[model samples]
Target: MDTGTLALLIPIMALSIPLFRIWTKHQKEIAEMEVAKTAERAAQYAASNKELEDRVAVLERIVTDRGYDIATQIEALRDTREVEGLTARSESGIN
Candidate 1:
């Protein structure tokens, strides 16, 4: 309203604008950090999943090479009544 009040208010308003900008910038930095962390965690999960897939492929190959049938193996594992060991044995005492 008056010259003195206007002079005081103008400097205060100018200082508040810089403080608001600084607060917003800090918030933006924090949000960016959170996004980066989430991306890193997602990458780690993807790597672990890929490793598990590779290990599964290796196991499948080993099983096939040992003359073990995949379908038969899955059926035998699904059978709750059977008490078969990890290694399958034929009726003639051969693996």
Candidate 2:
């Protein structure tokens, strides 16, 4: 209200301006760092998702490829087992 009080307040006001600027600058830097971290995490997630998709594609091929012939594979395995059993019985001379 008085000239003396106004004179004293000017220096404080000037100091506060610089302090506020520094605080806001640090806040902006921190926000930018968080943005960068979020982007990195998103990239990692995308890479992981792509890897999973590739694995699923391989599994799909294994299941759907005609060369995999599930019935024929099972029949071949059964034949081998029967042959082994018959051979074992003959070797033991058991009917």
Candidate 3:
């Protein structure tokens, strides 16, 4: 209302504007830093997941190979038993 009061208020308001701008700029910088950190963490998680997947694939291959080997051995044992039975029957002249 008075000239002196108006003069003081104008300078205070002008100074406050720049201070507010500085505060907002710092907040934006902090938000950007947080985003960057989150992205880095996500990338690390993805890499770890990929490594685990690769390890599982290798284990699966090994298990499949071992299973096939075991199956082949079992079949060979069955064939050998049958052959032995046939030989014993023939030698004893039993049908």
- What lDDT score belongs to each candidate, Candidate 1 first? 0.86, 0.95, 0.95
* Root-mean-square deviation per candidate: 8.1, 4.7, 10.7
Q: Where does the lowest 10-residue lDDT sum fall in candidate 3? A: 62-71
With a 3 Å backbone cut-off (N, CA, C), the pairs that clash in candidate 3 are none
Screening candidate 2 with a backbone cut-off below 3 angstroms (N, C-alpha, C), the clashing residue pairs are none
Ranking by TM-score: 2, 3, 1
Report the C-alpha displacement of residue 77, candidate 3, in angstroms: 21
lDDT of 1 by residue, 1-95 (tens): 99999999999999999999999999999999999999999999999999999999999888879775777878877784354532345554765
Clashing pairs in 1: none
Instruction: Highest TM-score: give the candidate number.
Output: 2
The TM-score, computed over Cα atoms with residue i paired to residue i, of candidate 3 is: 0.61
How many angstroms is residue 64 displaced in model 1 relative to the true structure, after the best TM-score fit? Answer: 2.5
Q: How does residue 66 of candidate 2 score in lDDT? A: 60
Q: How does residue 44 of candidate 1 score in lDDT?
A: 100
